[model samples]
Target: MFLSRCPLSHTRSGTAGSEAPATGETSLGDSLGTFRRQQDILTPAELAGMSVDIVGAGALGGAILLCLCKMGFGITNTLTVTDFDRCEAHNLPTQWFRPSDVLMDQAKVDALAEMVGWVCDRPITTACDRFRGDESRRLGPVVILAVDSLRERQLIWNNLRNREDVQLLVDARMGAEVLEIHCLDPRPSRRGTTRPAGPGTREFYEESLARPDEAFQEPCTHRGILYTTLGAAALVGSILRAHAREEDYPRHLVFDFRNFILLAHGEGHGETQF
Candidate 1:
């Protein structure tokens, strides 16, 4: 729900059978008028100057992209999307795509960028190759990892953790029964200290490697568009909340889709592994 506002504040309210005043038709001398007022509600200037590099344009990544674009994030945010996968027939039910988009001669990132370009107008930079090579890496103030592979997560953690400029990193694992959100605030010092700060330095990585891979299966055997969408919405909210606030929120959160429970970690937490 939107915030309630007094109509006397130069914002005209429509009567029972009358239409609201259109833009440029308002007698008020306000430059932005109501639009600026709404922009004040949740201005995305914090995300304006930052370049956001996203990996894995699958269900989770696609949802995040839509929310970010609708939030009025600048196109110049240097959007770099990389995905080697293509949209399949089965993906049409769970992932964001159209029948017309099916079997297109393009990668997932390319197809998504094309769809988003209609809203953003500016073309987004897309890479068809997997985000594996050193040259394929990009150091941004914020990096989003929505990939499904454990090895890929380890690689990204190793490459981006020690950078002094990178402020935040977020990872989401939306499984069938549970949705896990992992966040990391890259700083030299934090609550936990298992390792020294430097390149290839992450205590969480060492721990995760010692353990076996955690097995998971989809909750609903067939893709449920509803659950996928709901999880996506929750993930996007967390991302925007982190950016809008002056400080970070939690380092980890989990949502049990079966029981409908949401859990968050305490503050001062360090980097976390999958």
Candidate 2:
């Protein structure tokens, strides 16, 4: 019998079949073979050579990373994650870390990377420090900005707005039951360009970034909810799926889990139940 080598299995090492099977024995298929189920929706070819940078490993960031891992995104894609905080007891309720992770006092990115290793073969480049726009030379073409503060978002956007290397940016914000996601293209506008994002997009994003002190402050207990974070992650996955297909997606969206309402803005403006 002839065994077919799976292309998506190349990155995964030391799985069940690294050794040659004994004579007359059948080999267990590679770990990524399960991806066959979603072949029609997203193939490994669509994600080949893709690189993504996730700038936070808090509630929404951790949830999104797990969702992507389960979707076989790491098969042929590079992922980099940055976060400076350490796991704590409070994080357990909303974030992805286990109780043991908090006991060990692991950094958020480090703990998240370890969890990703268990879920998939994707190697995550972790930075246990804050992301400073001035210090960064270039980020991945696709960036997920999941930082908590409005000021941090402003700083990141200022650094990325004029960058030619960055094409897509997804910003996720959540407060207990309400979630907001913004998708932007940071490239400068050119005449006759048909890109979905341009000067108008930048202006709209800037308007949403009010002073941090002025923004509504939810009590610590009401800041994050697991279901809301998961909902945000699912919406992010939808945006990425559309991007992988080279299709258009909403530029901004808001989902109120408590009310079961979803409002999409820019290009595809509508209200519906989520």
Report lDDT (CA) for all predictions: 0.56, 0.70
List, residue by residue over 1-274, the lDDT tens digit for candidate 1: 6322212111112121233233223223222342365464455444556666677778778777666655544333555667777777767766666666665533577567666655433334566666652443445566677787666777766656556656666667666667766655654454254234321234543354334266344445643455655576556555655565655565566777778777765354343333
**Per-model TM-score on C-alpha atoms:** 0.71, 0.82
| TM-score, predicted candidate 2 vs. hidden true structure | 0.82
Best by TM-score: 2
Global local distance difference test of model 1: 0.56
Residue 272 in candidate 1, Cα distance off native in Å = 17
Residue 206 displacement (Å), model 2: 1.1
On the 0 to 100 scale, the lDDT of residue 176 in model 2 is 73
